[model samples]
Target: MKISRVTARGFMSFDRIDLELNEGVTVVTGPNAAGKSNLGRIIDVARLTVASHAGSQRGNRLDVYERAPRHGTRRFRLAVGIELDQPWEQELIATFVRAAYASSAVELPRPAHSPNVSAERRDMDARRRLAPESVAVLLRGFLVIHYDEGARPRWRASWHHSSTGDLYEAVEPVWIMNLRNGGPLMRVKQEPSAPALSLADAWRRVFPDDQIDARTPMPEQLDFMGILKRLEHPISLRTGAHQDNLPLLDSVRDLYMLLGWDMEDARRGQVDFVHVLDVVLQRACVLTDNRRLPLARTFPLEAVGGEADLEDGSQIPCELYRLKNGPLPLRQRYQRIQARFTELVGTGFDVQATPDPERPGNLLIDVTVPEGDHEYPIAFSGAGRQEALFLSTLLGGDPGRVIVLDEPGVHIEPTLQRRLIQAPDSTTQCLVITHSADLVPVTAPGDLARIVRLAPSHDGSQAHRIGHLDPKDQTRWLQTLGPRDVRALLFSAGAVLCEGSTEVSALGTWWEGSSNPPSGANISLIDVGGDKSFGRYIEFLKAFSIPWVAIADGPALRPASDLHQQMKKQGILTATEPDSAEPDFDAWKAFWAAHNVFSLANVFGNDGTAAGEFEAYLKRLNLELLSQVDKGRSKPRIGAAFASQHPMPKEIADLYALIRDRLQPARLQDAQGEQA
Candidate 1:
């Protein structure tokens, strides 16, 4: 199953977040403490919660009240919009539903004219009618897990029948059922006094005219206890009931039991829907986090006869043993893992599981790096190599599983980080939580739509996806800013978009000496290559709600320059240029300054000099010092050295003060009030 959307309220860092996810690899990124990890936690919780209901050993470990957002609602709700694969859909209808019908406890109404038709044939007919087409109708829905302050957690699984091919637009609840902790199963009724609808009723509501077997049991008459009891011995039930009956119900009961739910609870109410939901979740989703690598690194080795065993038998480290001695599928999985590792690390990198030299028969995983001539134990490898190994094991093993990776790029180098982002195949859906600038570049051009940027807000944290922007705007953003610039702007609390490297270097040098440096305040000094692109960069920053200020050369801000036209086109400059084709320095400066664009000309020209650029302004301040710098050095490098020794220019100092004040308005306002 692939999740198309996630909605959460009063959960973790979110008071309310409705995030629509894209297929393939979606990178979730933002500033520190902006709830990037919390987004992953939410998805992981949903995965675990679904697993819990299906009877997986992985159950929800978090307390609901503790996870609720501060000063927010005590109750929390988390829901996922799921689209099932063909196989899972078939299992729900043909396997689970068909078995429900074949139970001896469920009595179906017989057709008046078809008295000779056997019950077995009628069950087969019912399943055949519900296959492919009905599967599509039933598979598009949501699985919700929610809790109230004074109540235990409850689960509601509902499906929508779509006539217009839009799942989100689907208004009718075709199948509505609820599962409560240690309580009886409840089918949601349209009215309080009315009887709750069953899956069969849902089908009839959607396809009213279609003829169905009268043998199909109603919700109230269906014997859930008898069905679950028979599920314990699926083989016997298959022979006595329908020949096509699969052991799906047995797996469901096992999952339910694994979740600590008693078999006797099946007697309380109908749980046939739980059987259907379990198969969808258990078989289709896998959530993983970066914490796996550390565990694998510290896993203790124990000698078990002639084989290697981890003391705790952790699945992650034990995967190495499985690679060496498990079944053929696992060995084949190892080959895929090795291939992926080599692809990301380099052509010469190789991973192998061989006998440990110290422990005669015990197997140990070893790696051969391109730089090293001899192989070394994996434990001795660098963290980057180890992370690559762990990630490779995850991505290469299964193509069908939906993989959720939390901060996988933390230890990998920039180049490998880019490769890792592109590693997942087209068929595998991956949700990656990352703050790495290295991973941002790979999503450009085609996959820009896959970026979901989160930021802290008044309520809690909010998510914004590039896909939500107009297609033309997304394309323009790609053309305007480089990945590094995009990363700087997206992750910073505030950004200074400078025209050239000199302004970036000089301001950065000056800011470093200040009591409140840019880094300390989470501010970014981004060189936008040239002032012509400043308007585009500003627009992109504004789109994502990132605060920004621009610094431009005096010439760039002149009425006759190309930047004036670009800024005008972007609506950043609304004033009409002077009738004469000459620089209106004062008028243009004030016009752009109102939009937070500072000009070097105004700063230096106050001394009545014709200084129109940053280099010229620096020259005016200390010509001898600027000349004494190494001629081989780049302009920015010399600029940095020059700014480090001299006092900051008054205009630049004021701009710096403005940025600091804007970032902390209340402090600035209080100081102003004291002066007043």
Candidate 2:
């Protein structure tokens, strides 16, 4: 399932906001505290809540609402829209209320006494809002994986609270839900059905937890459990083995949830159920971040399942060494990771995962850069390369998972980011939160990928869907401009787009000489090629909400082109007075007085050739009997020289006036307030 929209009410720093998502990948961008990262966290929390509901519930009461913003309204609501291939859509709404259990008996009225009481006392106006079960039904059929800041995966053992207290049971409730029937549990071909045996009997025969409560939901038995239940002979259990291995067994289940059934099905057809459980139980992995794989000791490469001693003589997790039918051994998995990392990063650096000497059970990923004769650690390389390796490692292995990338570092090049996120109709769904414009692309409308911009609102922050670039315009932009150059426009406060390099230099020089300059004014003076390219640039800037205006040659000189008429139709240009007999630059000035944009073409003489370009018009405006202008002169060079030596021309001066008077103040205010 793909996320279509996220509606949040009173969710951290947000009073109410709706973020509509596209299919394959949706990039979230905004200034700091505008709540960009918070959006990702909200989704994670929503999914986690649903996952929480699939298993045991101690009571009807749940206290997850503790994290709600302290000062906002006492309630919050989150609604997510999911779309399935059947052309069906599901809306999941989760609500939370502050101190929901703190009220008197009246607040906790029984469902029979007042079935509507739950709705009446709900106070729909509350800022926080929902029960855990309200979100569970929608989370099925899709897996959501959240990568913390720096794009690091959160280890299975670490998803509980932040403390490091061997708290594997904290995840047991969620894990049990993952194995329940009709829960869209992974690693199996189909959802399990309700078991013929009771929960107590199933636990007694299969996995017996000393603490399991038989009354909770167990929609169906897992495949393994079903197999064990039907066995002709009872499998021998090591004395106290169930209690001693519960934690490790839970960890193995975590990996199975993520890796799915590819490895399991291979072993399923060949082995006895007892041997299968033994191999599955042995599956233990030491998870770490992409940047820092634990380096403890060195071990010899072995693929046939005998444990190799590390330099410190500690045993690696048996899972790493164990090989099952049709599954690659840990050594091969390591080599594959190294090769994929190299391919995605496009670097020849050698990556080896050797056992670290001092760390015993942990392995160290040694990155070596090739030098003339010797090699150096990969850390010696730049940050961008290192970040790329991390991202490549994180994204390469999984194909059908939901990946949430939190600030994967803006240093990853735009092209790579595009490739990583733009896989065509792939089952994987990627959501990225970035402050960099380089990661944002000009896409087709309703394309599989999109860019969403969040702006600050009075209640909190509001999110708006950013539309896409027309395909033809996007192609022209990419072909004519480098990714970096095009992306830079998004960061600029405002821009003055001109026909050629000459106009850029001329306007830049004039701005420098005036009370405000381009550098200090936080504006970009861009050479958009020519008159033909002006509309594309304008549309590009408008799509990103970047303030911009264009200056080009006269509209009258190019009669066949109705760019002016198009601009008027688009409401960008206003009507000017009827033509007068004589050339009066001031008379036409009234037409653009209220507009942020103006053109010198409106003021120049009707003489055809001279009004075709800015330089000709400048020369005509300063017509003198002994003028020494050269016809083949470098336009930008002459324009800059003229700007430095003489008073600003009337048209250029008036244009700057409109920019300062109409545009700069608002842009300046926004620039001053922009953060992150």
Highest lDDT among the candidates is held by which one? 1
What TM-score, computed on C-alpha atoms, does each candidate reach? 0.77, 0.55
- Residues 1-676, candidate 1: write the lDDT tens digits: 6777788887766778888777787788766667776665666666566556645565555444344543545567777777776553555544545444444213334435533444455355544454444434345666676756655544433333333325454244433444322122232333434433333333223333234456546412222222222222211111123223433244334334443346556434343445455555655566665454243322225531222222122344556555646579767877788789889876434445556666665655544455456655555667787788767777885565677787788778888988988899887888888778777653456677777777666556678755455768767777754566666567776778888898889889998888888987778888888766777777677666666778888877665466767766767665554444544578777777776777666542423454777888788788998887737789789879888878887777787987676556323322332110
Residue 541, candidate 2: Cα error in Å is 3.3
- Give residue 168's lDDT in candidate 2 (0 to 100): 20
RMSD of 1: 8.0
RMSD of each: 8.0, 15.2
Candidate 2 displacement at residue 111 in angstroms: 24
